[model samples]
Target: MPDSGGLQSVEASQRPDSQVRVFALPPRDNAAATTIVDGFLEALTSDDPSYAVARKYLTPKAAKDWHPERQTLVLEDGPRPHSTDRANAEETGRNFELTGTQVARLDDEQAFQPDDRRYKGDLHLSLVATGKGKPKQWRIDTPPHGVVLGKTDFQRIYQSVNKYYYAVDSAAGSGAAGAQKRLVADPVFVRKWADPLTETVKEVLAGPTRWLNRVVTTSFPLKAALRDGTRSLAPDDANKLTVPLNKSADSIGAAQCRKMAAQLLYSLRDLSSSSVDEVELERADGRLMCTLKEGAADALVAPRYSEGTEYQYFLDAKSRVVRMPASGGAHPSPEPVAGPMGEGERRMRSLAISRDQERAASVSGDGRALFVASMVTNASLGDAIAHSGAKAEKDGFTTPSWDGQGDVWVADRDPKNRRLLVFGQGQADRMQEVRVDELSDDARIEAVKMSADGARIALLVTENGRTRLEIGRVERDHGVTDGDVEISVADLRRAAPEMEEVTAVSWAGGSRLVVVGRESGGLQQIRYVQCDGSTPTGQALPGLTRVSEIAASDTDLPLLAHSDDGIVRLPAGAAWQAVVKVGTAPVYPG
Candidate 1:
């Protein structure tokens, strides 16, 4: 694919050792039809700019007509070639059936669209005459429109990356200074060794992926693009990256330009082995638009998951809300929060702490009532803010969750009255039943975890005895009065379709979640799944038995869970160790 950075052709032998490189060889002299097809397929997976080497194995007409970037077909297994007529050895042409199980497709926009179907395509090859009595060579004249790759090769060639954009002011309430400064992460896969910095920048400029486009806004202008003919982007000796934009951005103001740089700064935060401490935006004519240092960028754009949490809260044996230091040592002492919810007669089932850590919401032990209390003051549990009519606790409310806007969300599991409820900011008494537009009538929500940016929500939905993880976008149509507000979760799509059952899920990062689930006929396991439904290869955590609840933070805090061995935690590069022997519901401030 041609990145806006303008990819340039390079020979395989001349590639340096900076990044993992895939090199493919051209067909051997006078290769057979099958050999030619195999070589062509292998070459498609290599890192050749414009796929020059792969095109050489095709007939002249096919070379001119093929467009590798039009699409990408990812298969469960690599494409298998079956000779259509192996018995006809003397024939001047050959046809092969290429078949595999198609798992997903990448469109021209580079967004992954999940699919499941049997894929069957054709490959046609024929003997092409060489000039002046030279031996004839076999060449492919017909191939699939897009390149085909196995799951393994797809993972090998591409990597998951997050591009940042600002959450709408309406979603995350504006502050006195300005719009709430939270940035949402839009995750996509890009070629790992193909000048990723440039590719990522182009993607950010292109805008958010389809699911996130409506909820997030980019600072770059619609017509903004990399300076013409720019190839690769690398930091200088002092870890500074200079991005030259097209004429479209020539009139951008200093403040807006800094916001653009902030987006780029965090979007490229994980560039492998490179420390980009500073970002400088330059106009097409090389005039500086603005410069943003790492520290200054933080002031412009508050990263969704950059803030460290102080405490991890949960319910103790007494069904009271208690907390321990989020970075508490292995045996950190637990204490009741300073609120009636912790000391009052009313016990709790599940709870959520607001992102700001100022308020707490908890569901009554029977899951019938949801109460809001202040964690900063010793206030009463007060009257329940919401209720579920289900007689049985199991059929009542799932856990309550708080979005970044200080709004609360919970689901009533009562079969006859199943629905999601939202308590809007500054309007707790005006509870609204949020519509789940795409969910099937028979499916019911079992759990929910809202993203800190207040734009998306992770749901554990149950249907026919199986639970699955899905991500839904939170949409609100505001009215002049609080009673006129309409809330709904649109575009509910699976975030982990491979797992047969998802029991618990928590937001682990800006665009990632920690899930407790399992595949069909497999044991329960803890793993990380992207919000876009793509799983990062080799990211399953070490085994833990009977895991029922899981928690994670955007920062470096350890992952905590309620398991058979009681509450346990997994620190970076360490095994799961005991946290508390009696805790039940583990949670970190949202």
Candidate 2:
């Protein structure tokens, strides 16, 4: 095949505005100086932490000081190196100007911040010989300070592994011994050397990352290490991991033991079909204490309401909170629920329901105050958990999201304080404002939904003058006497980074979410994506207009959206159906 200018122009025109650089290691038994440099650079692009294969391309000393997490140079295109024929080419070192658009960077603290600038620099390369020989195999002597990778490869190789942590508070009236939720979705580079299951368990035992340390607490004993290190995690014939902990955990109690085992099971839930089906914890003396089975992972940790138990609530023609049945056919009518929020000026601006169907949280008519009221009869409007704390623009709070544990989560889009606030329910609820200083570059939350399991949050953030969808890990810390609370949202990362304007988001299932946004084409549409930032090839919502909001629940309930053509819906296993002629927001318990 030969190249043509006309063909090249057409292919270039079809390329996306955001181009991801490609990184592939070249094949070579022995290394040339250029091959060593190339292989080292390729390994930097990988998600591998220890840089095992990458170290093979480096000298012993250089590999030890190379910190890939120190900084990340996100390039717009692949790196190109220029070779020299100097007498001391392998000793004196070579230099070249590596120029490209640097889109984002990860700091020494491992926080990802978007830069989006044209980066130009002179990068130097130092090389060493394998041994004393004429055609000696060369290796990198001085490695680069930071990693460089294409955006596409970064997304492909870097995966977020969630570690289960106990909820800040437990569900009221539930007698479960230890309830857990997957909290931290720590991103790690996938390499043949690092096993995900082993890494996840080990990381949990090592305790939550620094950013989430203030919020999430682990049941793993302090400084607890796997008995045999990473190699101790081999699953037995029952697809079960018999974890033996170090002597430090010998004094831990039975309840704490089950929570620790639950963390292992839920964290490795996806691997149930292949490597792990259950997690069994052994005492320091090699005595079995508990076994968390695969089928009970979700129920034991992230439990949800059954699909048959309908709690489909929505806003009615009078802008009042009302309940609608999932079995309601095309002409199903809704009844106004009893509460102050349903009556006077307290009429809701936006509303959300807890999973237990015991309470409903709502924004005021003016959206400045947030109130929680009972969903059932003879219940009063609860206290105004938050007052407006805005300094710059329009001041208001979005819909209040209630988790399964009775804690309330909401974001005040105050430009002065783009604070995500959490209130732990009690005789006197305690509140903590999340410190999201650079969330999507100071973006304000327009709409947010807490997943039924209370692990993750789907946020519709207004960033760079456009709406985008992002998922944040829900990390909480609470106290016993006072119900002290603090929530730390994970560092901002877009779920649909390539999409132009994301208007709304809702969790459609445990691991999937339904979002309304557009990439490059027609009207805004609804699509599905994994919580870990992967696109799922599900059927798109057909004949759906631009939606103002989206509402979903724990079961096979209808997918409801508030569009310009009134409240439209897509019923379970059926086509799109219009539910009401007049409604602004549709909601369900949790």
Candidate 3:
């Protein structure tokens, strides 16, 4: 076939039970330098478990020194091979420069570090003579360290997995052993088709990454590791997994041992086919220590809500708080909540329910006063816990969000008195002013949403008249007693970097957010973005118009949004259906 404007296509097919595999071809006889360089790059992105085929393209010394696991550089569009000026028809050795726009780097810890810079690396290939009548062959003598892959190829070759760790209760006295037993997810990338079982387990023993280490604690004992030279981990025919620890963990108690097993079970939950049903731990002497079954482990570390969300609340046309069963039928009847805000004594512009669903916080229609009241009883609206002096409603307090720790967070958008405030768990009398560590001088928060685990927070930050979404780590320092607790938001990173403007955002699931925004000069669209700023392919949902606010639960339930046509709900694999004729600010318990 003739060349057609440098365009080409390849068709792939496979059975439903099988997966698609990519292979790398070995170097051919009398191959040119370009072929050797290109073939080695292709092999780095293939399914070779140990990259054995890629090593065949290099010299013996280069092959022995190359380490593919050291790092992975991801480029915008795979590397481009350019023949250097040093290469000509006369030289036996040739040099080539691989160039591209580097987008990110996957370090040895399997953590993806985002980057944007130009990349240039040198590869030298030499021709070697054959012993017999065969022609000489070109081989890579000096190759770049580790591997380099394109964005698309990296996504295809690697997968995202979350390793569970217990959240550190800074409000409690001290030490992780006494902290709350809440599970926090630490995400990392591993090979999709490679020995993921062993790879993921190894990451667990290595402990959490630096960014998340301050807020989480792992069950793995110090210096605890897999037994000497142990590999090829897999469940037996009866769906039982046995893990043997090194000598450092031989003296651990039964309770700590079970916690270790629970961490392993949660880390491997995303594996295909749910192959593991039970986990057994063994000491260095091969003696059984503790065992945990799938059903039993659920009691120890379960989802956000064991029983599920009780109700979803929103504001009716009268600006009164109303509620319906969260898991109700397509159109469940909406009734006012049992509180003064629901009784129409005070009209609220927006509201947030605590994680326990026992208390509610409502902002007045003018957004100047924020009241906290009991949801279980018909209690009168209490005195304002927070007040914004800004006269304009748009410049007053934003919606409040509650974390699992019972703390309420809200931002005062008044340009003159901009501040982020937090109301402590039991201290309603004291409204603590929070200082965001790295926030810019001109930036102001438009909205705030906290994760259920109380480890991370999402903020719609506006700077220079453009609003963007950012994720920050919640750090708490309780000096000696609960009254001396200090909180600060640190390490802010863009969650949706490509969006030019973000209007509404919500935590859709663990480490995922449903964001409503638009690109530069583009129409508004709804998309799902990962906490690390990587947008998964095909994650965009059906388009909806005039979406003022959006809400999603941690569990995989229907998505509710307040759009121009009133409240709309999107069930799995279904279009946006009408939830009510008129409503606004639909939300589930955080």
Candidate 4:
């Protein structure tokens, strides 16, 4: 594709206007390079010298090729117009003389040489018409091999121009180059890498240790006065003097006295050349002694005696008696003697001494009291009952339960044998023990809880996946026999077949008992069953996970469920809400 300057105009036979023709020169051998360069140069019209139209046809490779150097096209004329007169032509030619001409002549004697393939040369041609009716048109056509297009040159031109425009647009569009210019304008940015140690040294020189010390000293009165105020004075004298600036009242008084004492002692020893020594002062009766140092005469040591002497005292080298002196007078008469006290008297005195020990443990309701089966010693149980001043019976057994009337029912947990012992309050030896082995395997009595009226007892037993709730009548002598204990075994799988294990069992209100079990899906379900050990009466309470323990509140309206996460208060008919969180083990009151 020819450049704008190289475009040729041809005379149109049909139209009055001339048509401009642009020829795309083919490369010698490379087809790709020829297309790229030709397409690019053809785009450089008079209207778009920036090659805006040429860029569309230019590939990325072609754009890269023409980026570096400036380019221009040189055009040659083919034919000259015919002249009518020879004289006029000669006169015109004489008037227009061409200079700076070099001529090369081919001699006949020299042999014609073949053109070298690598050598490039330019051809100059001129044509003139001399005697013709209509001057014949003379046209010079480019030879195929002599003036053919070069693919490398064409591609290089396109690529160079494209790159120039790309760079111009990139810088102008993003303002990245302008930002870089501004950044470089700062001297800090330019010298950041130079003399880094000097910058560190300057920073160290500007550190604030001195200023911080000044601030602290200016704000602390005691320290400032101690460091800068008067010295060698008494406390009373120092109090009369004006207080130092920024010093607190308490701190000023104390510091002034201390400073005065320290300075006086230092001056006496250093400036006055004085020394201190201790001495013993003896009294005339040789029964008492006193010791003191010279400067502290006002201070006294208690009188002491040696070898049954009457008086003795200690004095300093300055002849100052430092100890309390004995008086020259007779001693007073001794008081009347008393006999030694007996064990009974001592015991009476010992009643005044208080002992630190747990006095008693009591729960509000009798049902809860029975639920917390006591394994406590007989003395403590008796003490608990006696301290309440209620009728308490020890039953000659460690495990005790107080009936509403203060009668204690003690159960002995011996397998193959079950004994329910009954005793009156404070009567440890007088107890009636009843055997009820036929009712249960004594080891299976997992828990025991009395009813609210103390007339019935509910004993729970876990046997495999089945739990038994035995409701028994409280008897005076024939206690908890098979006939008295009404046993009902609840197959938990049938009741709550999805449960993996029962986590907790507690009695709620009336005959309602709560059995909390963990399901296979890692959720906890609390089922309410009657005392007769029947199927759960209501819908299983939902939305509990990992229930570790459960306790019924005293009011039986809220069930406290303990889990790894926290303690949740599950209302009787509502969902559970976290009430408290315990990171460690929890202690629940009965």
* Candidate 1 residue 590 C-alpha distance from true site, Å: 2.1
Clashes of each: 0, 1, 0, 29
508-560: candidate 2 lDDT, tens digit per residue = 76656788888766567788766655554325666577687887765567888
TM-score of 4: 0.26
The better-scoring model by TM-score among 1 and 3 is 1
Global fold similarity of model 1 (TM-score): 0.92
Q: Which model scores highest in TM-score?
A: 1
Error of 2 at 288 (Å): 3.5
- Model 3 RMSD in Å is 4.0
How high a TM-score does candidate 3 get?
0.92
Cα deviation of 335, candidate 1, in Å = 1.0
TM per prediction: 0.92, 0.71, 0.92, 0.26
- The superposed Cα distance between candidate 2 and the true structure at residue 52, in angstroms, equals 5.1
Better of 3 and 4 by TM-score: 3
* Ten contiguous residues with the weakest lDDT in model 2: 184-193
Per-residue lDDT over 291-401 for candidate 1, one digit per residue giving the tens place of the 0 to 100 score: 999999887776454275788888888877788887766677779888786774687878888887778888888889888888756576678887789988899888888
Task: Report the candidate with higher lDDT, 1 versus 2.
Answer: 1
Runs in model 4 lying further than 4 Å from the true structure: 1-434, 437-443, 464-467, 477-503, 518-524, 543-549, 553-556, 572-574, 578-590
Per residue, candidate 3 scores C-alpha lDDT tens digits across 284-355 of 899999999987777776458514787788989888788877666777788988868678687788888888
Candidate 1 regions exceeding 4 Å error are 1-20, 86-92, 129-136, 171-177, 303-306, 479-485
Supply candidate 4's per-residue lDDT for 349: 6
Q: Which ten residues in a row have the lowest lDDT in candidate 3?
A: 10-19
Candidate 4, 500: how far from true, in Å?
Answer: 8.4
Ranking by TM-score: 1, 3, 2, 4
